[model samples]
Target: MLRYIAFTVFLLVTGAAGADRLETSAGSVAVTQVVGGLDTPWAIGLLPGGAFLVSERDGNLLYVADGTVNRVKGAPKVSAAGQGGLLDVTVARDFTRSREIFLTFSKKQKGGAGTAVAVVRLSENGKRLTNLRVIFEVTPGGSGGRHFGSRVVEALDGTLFVTIGDRGDRPAAQDLQNHMGTVIRINRDGTIPGDNPFVRDQAARPEIWSYGHRNPQGAGLDSQGRLWVSEHGARGGDEVNLVHAGANYGWPVISYGTHYSGQKIGEGTSKPGMEQPEHYWDPSIAPSGLLVYSGKLWPQWKGDLFVGSLKFNYIARLAGTPLREVEQIKGPETERVRDIVEAADGSIWFISVGQGAVYRMTPDT
Candidate 1:
């Protein structure tokens, strides 16, 4: 059994299962395995009663508590193929009383598939969900299974924001008529937010908050409640952008990276109307999860941004207005870090896809 040391001191113990003790500029850090035997867990939501809700890519929502993983029933049927399947899960702030959970998944449509969102009520015992319903779904589902930019975040005012990819159709990102390659906003019941960017634009999807995003997977609200996202670019040019309503992020039009065929993208990374990324990675770490650290155990890390590196296998520590990678935390437990979350207690939790386990990071003692 792994022992829990007091948080006030610094001590490193090794040889524990799923625990990797490392030293960093902040101080000693320890990552311990909380639960394992998951099948490609994509995202996690913190539950009120000390349990975690984890979504697996194979179309299963798992309830993990007391070191045991239980499969949650009543999730929407998903198209679990090629970067699709069950994705992000977010719990409502008043979860204890509301029992409402939001989910984003790759839903199969008539001839193709698209990213879809659903709202469901988790049972009191945490066994299943009832009253399942789709709150939002991307329009004009297209063929192929790539680039489902599915991530869900609840804004401070309880509005919902979801990301949808271009579905391998690069040019579609620039089109506002369909839901592809856009960030959309809606009410809790899936109604279009009146303040959404394109709500008045009859030619555009009214739910679109912003457009021209490529395969965005990581999204989170900062300490100030500002929404930010990390998206993947071709060959290179991964980006982190501060999302704004009515904004147009240059995707295919102005990219720092070349196409997979080594062709130049757009008119070269600069245009009058397109918004620039807050930070970008040239070689592409393939960012997946994002969290703005509200540090509790490590007070020094508060306000810093924590991002997962899927390609390089590490957690990136970014700082500054135009974010820059200051540190990369990687060790035995660092594996295809897929999703990241900061618990109410301020402990850091992440889904390590490489290890098929959910790992927790805390101050060493």
Candidate 2:
């Protein structure tokens, strides 16, 4: 049954794109393609000036404004191999004054590559990045082209939260001496936060906020200012977790999933000390970007969470305290939805990686 579902999703994601309408529980949605000709676009950051900063997995930074997309220069050299490459991009809250932006990418090093975060100043005309400097990087880089989890989210208090993967090394998730498989919290200037969980632990990385995560690709704050993350599981067990400081989310130590070879994993699912997921999926949907809905545009959807499903090729709308998947949104043009965001006007925007386009989802009249 899971294989059948996956096959169906594969067809949908690979189908030709032309349809402009999608039927949803709330109402009909008009799907408009904003721009195309992108190469494996990874994430989108909305600018205060009503533009967009888009990053491609091939290490290109693009500025999209008024239907025109231009490649921005001065991006750091990245290992554009497999899952490694330029990933998420975010603009500062005070962009008007600071013109600062944050970017996450897979940084190449001697042995292999690791997730890295940097801050740069966007030029006035959006042509290039200035003052570019890496703010945070995962240490003890290992080999392999998979699991360079890089997602950046800024807290309301102005701290930056970066999600990193285990770098295909399951045991490393339990290690505190390195930055692998951890959520790192740092100040805007790349300094460790004094209040960070491991700040006083001389043996641990001070930037570590939480530990034992595997490929956390999506991160955002809820309406109440709480951090939430969506992470990928091994064969199954895709999870939505409410992140907290000093907490440990069991990865290889305890997983609701099995090895790719279909063997049991880690002393069964539940453990005494490991934190449990708010929600999990048995047949993983390969969740990527996540956003808690405000219902500003869709009144009924307020407070719900929207997730981009790479495995299923749809948008999963989840609600309730312990989150549950309530709906899967599908349209003819819908491709592998990579990232999701709510526009200032309340409309939702998402990137379709399979189609190489950005799409707007608005209410159909």
Candidate 3:
């Protein structure tokens, strides 16, 4: 019994249960597709009550509980064109007591759409949201579908973290005065945090946390209170970066990848001032949502990072210090994964971008 127990412990430590995984260099088996009958699902906010709140790109918020999905009405009218639609949804940490929720989207505006992030108080039974207000908005307005600069996360200290896309205007990423291409730190109510790095830049927006990024679709905190961001590159060089406060991540410049027509992006890789990625993809996986595992369903997958690949149609189970890829949950061309959330019950929740379905990948056991 002692020998058997020792071997089990070893397996868990090495993360080698080898259950089923996306068919990649380190993984095997295809991801089982769950229910597939919704719109373009964007994000998943797992609630404290074990249910989930899902958002679609068409401005619809749905409540999913006990395996039933109910379309939530009264969502704000969003710009339903191109990349302008409802995006991420997240319930407040004290949602049970406060009944507040947070959302990020592309708000329709003159000429183009302005990126907006808001936190509102939800109804008692989660039917509708009241007191809706925009807490963050990208100024000078963006028109194209290039970048909305999204991803909202609240640290344990109650401060909120938000990412802004470069809005297809590369040079704006270097300008801390603009919200585009920045990670902003704000209070839970959409006010600026006093300790923010750019709070004193005088010329810079006070919300700026880090600047110079393309589109950081995925941003989350690790166990040690560090921030992890996954962003799409121009041609190659999709990157997973460790974000630091008030730092600069060179965008359109110093990228490992060049332009679509083989033009050099910037001053080439490795500049003096720009931060580098912990890991990057050469072919561009079009990475979107991200999550750090704190689950037990796949006992071996604890303490790792999982990202949903939109272009690759796979879920990358990355490992290592900053997480290199050890496995992938490719669905065999079944779905475009937008977000991956490890549920409170240890199940994997995959949100499909095109299919608009909420799939829960559970252990076959």
User: What TM-score goes with each of the models?
Assistant: 0.94, 0.94, 0.88
RMSD of 2: 6.3
Worst 10 residues of 1 by lDDT: 1-10
**Local accuracy of candidate 2 as per-residue lDDT tens digits, 254-364:** 888899999998888989889999999999889999998889879999988888888889999999876899999986455788899888888898998988877878888
Candidate rank order under TM-score: 1, 2, 3
lDDT of 2 at 249: 94
Tens digit of per-residue lDDT, candidate 1, span 1-365: 12112210111222134457978778888888777666788999998768889898978887866545557889999998889999999998878888999999999998789999999999877889999989889889978989998889999999998989899998899999999889999999999878787888889999999999988999999988899999999989999999999899988899989998998998898899999999999999999999999978788888888899899999999997667999998886778999999998898999899987788888888
In model 1, the clashing pairs are: none
TM-score of 1: 0.94
Where does candidate 3 clash, by residue pair?
Answer: 22-328, 22-329, 22-330, 149-164, 149-165
Q: Mind giving the per-residue lDDT tens digits that candidate 3 earns over 108-208?
A: 77778877888887665667778887877777678887688578888888888887888888999998777888888889877888889978878999988
Model 1 stretches astray by more than 4 angstroms: 1-18
Name the lDDT value of residue 136 in candidate 3.
75
**What is residue 78's positional error in candidate 3, in angstroms?**
1.4
Stretch of 10 with least lDDT, candidate 2:
3-12
